[model samples]
Target: MSRTSVPPRRARTALLAAGALVLAGLGAVSVMQSPASAAGLQCSVGYSVNDWGGGFTANVSVTNAGTTAIDGWALTYAYSGNQTLTSGWSANWTQSGKNVTVTNLDWNKTLAPGGSTSFGGNFNYSGTNTAPTAFAVNGTPCNGGTSTGSPTPTPTDSTSPSPSPSTSTPPATGDLVDNPYVGAGVYVDPEWSAKAAAEPSGTKISNQPTAVWLDRIAAINGANGSMGLRAHLDEAVKQAAGKPLVVQLVIYDLPGRDCSALASNGELGPTDIDRYEHEYIDPIATILSDPAYKDLRIVNTIEPDSLPNLVTNVSPRPTATPACDVMKANGNYVTGVGYALAHLGGVGNVYNYLDAGHHGWIGWDDNFAPTAQLMHQAATTSGATVDDVQGVIANTANYGATTEPYFTIDDTVNGTSVRQSKWVDWNRYVDEQTYAQAFRTAMVTAGFNSSVGALIDTSRNGWGGANRPTGPAAKTTLDGYVDGSRTDRRFHLGNWCNQSGAGIGERPKAAPAVGIDAYVWVKPPGQSDGASSAIANDEGKGFDRMCDPTYTGNVRNGNSMSGALPNAPLAGHWFSAQFQELLKNAYPAL
Candidate 1:
């Protein structure tokens, strides 16, 4: 559940004249439009396209020019050449014949004066792909021409005001837009590709799902340009061509990472906070901020397993080490996270989600409030507002079921009376959905914008029929029978490293719940959490007793189970056996 590797690491248009051109070619053509005159409103549209041989990607921006605001608006346009719509984002796109219309989603319906919103579409094209010519907003033409309507009269101030200096303050509400950058494409890691290719055809791991992880060890080692952060990015961009590149980067490598567990030990020491900022964070930020990557939509999960430990396991847990105290005393966790939030958060297209750990870690009352306060303070210290972050991510690299079928946290089962046990306390009784919603409410109450969304790591929380019980057993006892009967229970809450009997959870989806933004595979399915024991390797990960099947779980580490996983590889490395198991036991029978 912790990482320690390190390495590596836009639009448009104008009234066709004053706006800048972003990309030019068959691959992408983007133009920004200047203000056009409409009687009651002045509006402009910026258009951009990403072309890939038979198909292309297009994004359009609608800007309001006049001083008055509109509650709703619709855009209408027609393709000039042989182009057909495939899919679109941020708006509802529909076509009849050659014309296409885009309407706003519920969240993005309102626009303030001088405000703008962007939508993108993927299209199929033939030999020639020409930009659309005519565009209209709410029936008003945006062809760099004036509209016919009676203009609103300007009002004059009655009283003279004394001259004084004005100070700019942050907006009362943060940006309400969901992760604006969109495309279905995910950046496939070259290493993962190689691994998959090496496997024989028809093998389970030959087509396993994989993701890219940026940890502390890789960053520190890769900073000097020897190991290739830029190279990986360049390759991903090339593979994406003109398509949207969805890259997942874990901004880990804090000084005292994994304070509660030693399996995923990081290379960086607690006192080396400055090195983390310069050698680690700054270089990665520079690579991502590079102009060549303006089209790539980066999803950064900042400091998984780092922040929540500062709340729950830092002080009270006996298994916690001095590293936690050092992190707290020197403000390493907050400052490092804040640095990441400010530096990467400023990137125009990057969507940063600070890790809120799993529901098991922060779902309790004692841990929830403090975690929110920590996140708020981190944002402030980093010189970034809550607006800079997209939202909070829970269950980043943990195995927690998305839902529990038989039980609810309300202490009732099928309308029958049921008593909640101490182990299944109010906090522990919830699933990822309930946990995320409650956490979102708590975070917004702690001063985050109401628009802030939630994300869950559904990579491996699917407990399929094999592990689940056939029928409800006696609920009389809390120890052996209750734990055995519960379908959603984990072998041990603290056992995170290469958990046994785990299955691939829900597939990636967007807006799965009320406050949730997306159900993402933050942790790649096949990658090992850590090795069974310390083995000398270039990956810079160490061994822990937790991954060994022989090592009985203990109360000190909060792992009170019998069996630990056996034969797992180092953290972030490919484990073919584990991959096969995941595929065989996949939830929804993937």
Candidate 2:
């Protein structure tokens, strides 16, 4: 999809306050134009007048009508009655009472074989009139009979034959990936600040639409009830005013002590979790149901890590089922999640990507493919189909760069290094690209080509290549491991409180290559879960071990981490310098 232009001219203050409504209202105008025919080549004009109440801003679209290319052209016609042209674009417009002419804009001088372009103008007219006469292209007169009177008469039963149908081709659908991501995730104030600081220039975090995760919203204001912050959050969201930003949500509360049932995080008890589900997740889902949020896109994980851990780790150990009868089943969890996502109505612009654990977390033979099948079966059994679930995401948090990492059950005993290993693979070795390819290929190998693909977390990997050793040994390790299978699936980079320069990577090689699918700051960088202290893990210090209050670009052993903080005024200067250096490695313009 082409990136639509932002509104013409408006004050920053007014834009933040009423931009959404203004943009929506602007949608009523006829800004879109299409060729009269699709097969060969066709050109037609569309006009829209943006009257700031008094004058009008006229927008126009010009389409190509032939299969072969044309370099330059001019449009001319007689404007009989009271129409007077003021200004225009895509081409320059000039008029003298009854005569008008339009010349192509320098940048749009060429009308590619079957392509089209649009131009706009501001006009002052007392009333509508008969259409123009003597339409000509490149000084050659079109065959349409010229009009002599006020009301433009249609060319009826003339000797000139109608132009043949167009034969040009259209662009691909996946091109939709080119549209820019225009929203942000805010779970906490500090998280919001860090995010604001990381955005690039020409974009402002305050203007971008934002979504506040319900879990984070509840945890911030010392509220015992889930609805306590509803009004507060709505206000905070509006504070950015209206600049086309939107909110995203995830409903994590569910009843039942069954791990697979819903909302059963290993940390929370069954009863309390159920209440939080009913009071918190449910009401928020209701707020999302509002028509205002119809365009919202969300990743509804009733409980993330619900599947991978439940089937592989949680079900087997610790719980220790006495017999087959006592063992818990995966049906409730899978089915419940499906029902929740479909029924979680009212939210706008939402898309759900279920969780698929990291490549290092599970074994090759451990039935990764079957996991998708099981989820599908559960969803279908509960009347949900593959379509209900968008896709899946592979996550690696807490495990970070560590291998024997799954649980930190003993933070009091020994903070960072205490965890159990459930599989032979290490969960922290795969880089963004490697992990992306791993999950994509695995899904395909498991025959999920039609059903599932993967997304990777670039939240932590700052180094170019995987931290793991490379060479013959690395190739040997990957010999039997699938690496590039699910190339068709969405490849989003999951970052937390995204800093501008951090987590940047080489663009993907595919037609719409994967660098950052949505650039989702999934973890919302700044918030602490109360598990680790600032002293022991220093979350306040931000990136590396720089010990700075906020992370920004600074050189360390010939390596630079610039532009990591977008909103930081002091930090922006340093970031700008580093990006200039980085761009030196970019592809030269032809």
- Please name the candidate that would achieve the greatest TM-score relative to the true structure: 1
Q: In model 1, what lDDT does residue 127 have?
A: 77
User: TM-score of model 2 relative to the true fold?
Assistant: 0.40
The per-residue C-alpha lDDT of model 2 at residue 425 equals 28
Candidate 2 lDDT tens digits, 333-407: 554465554434212233455656555434334545656555555445433444444445554221122111222
Error of 2 at 515 (Å): 10
Taking the candidates one at a time, how many backbone clashes does each contain?
A: 23, 46
Backbone clash tally for model 1? 23
- Regions more than 4 Å wrong, model 1: 1-177, 180-183, 197-210, 217-227, 316-319, 413-419, 426-428, 470-485, 538-540, 556-559
- Quality of model 1 by C-alpha lDDT: 0.65
Worst 10 residues of 1 by lDDT: 162-171
Distance from true location, Cα of 107 in model 2, Å: 47
The CA root-mean-square deviation of candidate 1, after full C-alpha superposition on the true structure, stands at 17.1
What TM-score does model 1 achieve against the real structure? 0.65
